[model samples]
Target: MLVSSIGASIVQTVGGAVKIHDMSWVTGSGKTMSALLLVPDGASADDKRPAIVLAHGWWNNKQMQDSNYVELARRGYVVLSIDMYGHASSDPLQEGHEMDAATGMYDGVKEIASLPYVDTTRIGISGHSNGARAANFAIPIDDKAATPLISSVYLVDNDPIYTDETGKYVNYYGDRDVGVQADQYDEFFFRSYDANGVALTAPRDYIGTPNAQSFLHFGADPSGQAARKPYTTYTQSVDGRDAVREIDNPAQTHPWGPFSKQEVTSLLTYFDKTLGAPTAIAPGSQIWQLKEGFNALGLVGFGMFLIAFATSLLGTRAFAGLRAGPAPALVPREGRGLLWFWGSLVVSAIVSGVSYWIISANTAVGTVSFLGDPPINPQGAVWIIALWAALNGLVAIVIMTVSYRVVGRRTGVSLRDIGVLPGWRRFWQGILLGAIVVASAFLIVFVLAYFFTTDFRLWVIAIPTFTPNKLAIAGIYLPFFLLYFLANSVAINSFNRFAIRGREWGNTAVLALANGIAPIILVIAQYSHFFITGELISGFGGINSIWLFPIVVILPVAAVVTRKIYRATGNPYIGGFIMACVVTIVSVSNTLTYTR
Candidate 1:
């Protein structure tokens, strides 16, 4: 009853009820895949609605097409959003822990067909990047009865897997309609590849070659292959059937395309033409933003809950044993000087960026970095991030030591005043207190989710409680989180605590920037390049966008909390523990990890 009300409320917020469900099905290969199905209003089991299967690219999950789902479901088409193999909530392969992406999409098609309110004859498959390749792979396959499950397909900013050297895939796609929405300024797909698949001459012109021209024209070599065209539509015959083909060359870059209206409209236009009978809901008339905005509101609620939950307990007589010691006076309590002010930010960015680049490469998968088991994926990105955290902390220590020890002879600083290092007993007490705080927060969140069947989620941002599987994984990864936060707390507390000539706010602002400027600059540079030059920065394209803002916000927000805790307890450990545990839970719960 609670779940139904919650779901109803979310639907109303997004406009109206589009009956949504979490579903699972076993593939032909015995692997269980997870998916979300959105049923249109007023559709009975007997009224089979045209269905579309939406799959995300590498490291992404079902919510990648949130806009599409909201809009499409309102238009009366059943939408099935799947978490591909070895990702999110799917049952992953234990045999090598690696499975082909195509298999998941193939099984997703079958799942949509299994639904009572879905029309098996009117299914459309769509994917972005690697996911587009998967759709290309799955749509061409014959089911058990030798019938095609997908009648049409949409490929977003990627080459199809079926497009073999001999034009075999194009020949196969001739039976149905296909649409290509390639950003002309795609960093990797368009410019980074030659006819021979070598990664050379990047930022190359998109339409300046015979191979690309032929691809743009659906396997027919273009007479004018020497110039770029932003939009072209064509209809041709393949397999003795009229096949409609189109190539759109939006001037946008690759990374931001999936989330944009142009991309969604192009997709909707393609599906309408191919599938036929789609309701005419004009593009851009969407209320999904309200849902996303609600998510942001809930995220703010999450932070407030943590602060209230932790700070209130700390004030209790029972928890008073974990109180902080007195803060010691440090060098130049006025500030770390102008030299240290700007220097720390620049130094931290370079150190952290360089460290992340080198170390994460050893484990990153397909331009995305994280911790992985058999191979790197989004989860691997998580692991890589955790590793980067540790590396960053170590660098902070070295830099702090060097700045104090080697950089000055008369710095008026000693080991004793370098922030609070509570006595060993009190330190252990802080650890215990931190653990309780984490447990309390989780208890509250878990109850809400378990009983109400709701998570504090808004759009792409979420604060979700973990399942048993994820909780176990969190245990393995939590210590690394603690280490990073501890190092960060120590460095920021000691170095950033120096007042800006008694202007506490100014000092805090600088400190916050010092802590988070690396990611902030990285994101800024990445987006700026695409906007200014119309080309993606290539390497940071994939998973970094997920946590970009949230990850960076940690420093500024947590710095304030850390300072307050330091002011109260004179111990960085308490702040570090609390922040680390909170962030870990928030990130890990929301992220898609291997269910296996």
Candidate 2:
């Protein structure tokens, strides 16, 4: 059936038992917002039923919440789903209006609670996608501050902001959803506290803060069991009991599936359990239940097996010998000594570890202390540290393989012919590269901080306030950026050399294609996360945050320009420097303009 027709008929089919009303309210900021409210059949002014407020995902409207509304109302609860700012019936406000919409949602909830039949004491809020993020932000605000409202929260399929050592968000589905992280909500809550002081942050520090509970539900089944593999079944020790939670649903995606019969049953069960209904449902316990399914050993073993298989394939005689045919002649001219390669690899690994530590420290969650204090759980700590070390080692191996491919091919030397650099040169070069990397990272951080922090003036031109954490973050970003730049330059240089041997049109065509396609790929990767789940990168508000779009576009143009310059100069180094400068200038200018 057509969507419009389906919507119109839904309420009618439910009859006068439920009253659906569309309403608008003005926010504290003077923005008018629109919402849909469902009042159960014969809900008297004195009925005092629990109410749920819903927030929709990106590019979606209140109708998306209709399924949940029907289910909740059938369970004898009132539900309200609002169109966030700039969406559906709500007026367009500004960029990041989702934040404002969240405030407005609280206001509406307050209005709902005041109605005689609605139980003010038993209120809850739930959101999906961007809505989910807004809900997270709303719940942690001090009950006495700003809107002065509080409610239990349900975040669906959204990542909260928090980071692991690798600069990845710490969650079961860290990169799985692209947009939201499990730790993000916590980070935002903490940062908001830091910015607003104790008045805003202190009250909402824990799970049951302000007499309200917050819960998260990430849909487990997508693409049938295909998306559920590895994470599908496992065992966990919960409350001293080894329990298993298997994900049996085959239809759910990033967000919970619409309130189908099964979904309604599950959701009602969860709400009844969490919201003080008579029959206790164990729905909210699913998160813990699901965690039982994660088999760390199995995951690691599978990864190792894959690595072994790949290494075996790459080491095969046919592949190894094929590249050797034209390699010898190039070795003497293009090769860095074997020592240089090995030293560089070691330095890169050190830089990576330092950078990870630094970024983790600077963020709102602060640094993880390994040595200074005893860990809360020494055993878990040991495992995590070991995993990090192993990952870093893996990274070093990958870097070595990459270095071998580039240096070996260019210099016409086999990996076996590489030698160690002298101690002095190795030391100095490592220091120099490390310094350059650190400086570059600082520049990026300063630029980003200027735009993000309210106290931009303090650090924009003056010497930055360097805490151990800030320094650590700088250390991390610097080397990673350097290695990234070096790899990019080398790859382009090699590719250009290959292309130069082709016809002029073919070379230009290939360059143009690559330059044109790269940004498109990046943009797609950046925005696709929103469709999968309703969160965007912090600071960047997704495609709607179009401030970075120009920069993305300029990068391809700059690449083309640099390629041309390289061909003309026959010096890849010069071309790389010029491109780097261009990018830096663009970045700085954008930062200054936007931040100010």
**Most accurate candidate by lDDT:** 1
- lDDT for position 370 in model 1: 33
Q: Write the per-residue lDDT of candidate 2 for residues 1-596, one digit (tens) a residue.
A: 12222333343225445676667777656866767777776567766688878876654456555556655665567778776664444554343344553635665666676677777666777666566676655653424355434434545445344434553333232111111212212212212233335324321232222211111123221222322221132333434533332222223333333323344444455456445552233433222111111222222222233223322332455322211122222222223544444355345436544433433334232222111121222111122222333344355446556665766566663333322221444334333332343345345434532332111111011112122322322232233323333333433443333323434545444444443343354446545653444344443322222222443444344445444433432333333443343333222221100000
**How accurate locally, in lDDT, is each candidate?**
0.65, 0.41
lDDT of 1 by residue, 445-555 (tens): 667544433445543455655445666666666777788888778767765566566666677777777778777777777767766755556556534544465667776
| Ten residues in sequence with the least summed lDDT for candidate 2 | 453-462
- Name the weakest run of 10 consecutive residues (lDDT summed) in model 1: 362-371
- Give residue 119's error in model 2 in angstroms: 0.4
Model 2 lDDT at residue 228: 25
For each candidate, what TM-score against the reference? 0.84, 0.35
Candidate 1 residue pairs in backbone clash: 295-458, 324-569, 369-381, 370-380, 370-381, 371-380, 371-383, 371-384
Shift of residue 516 alpha carbon in model 2, Å: 23
Q: What is the clash count of model 2?
A: 30
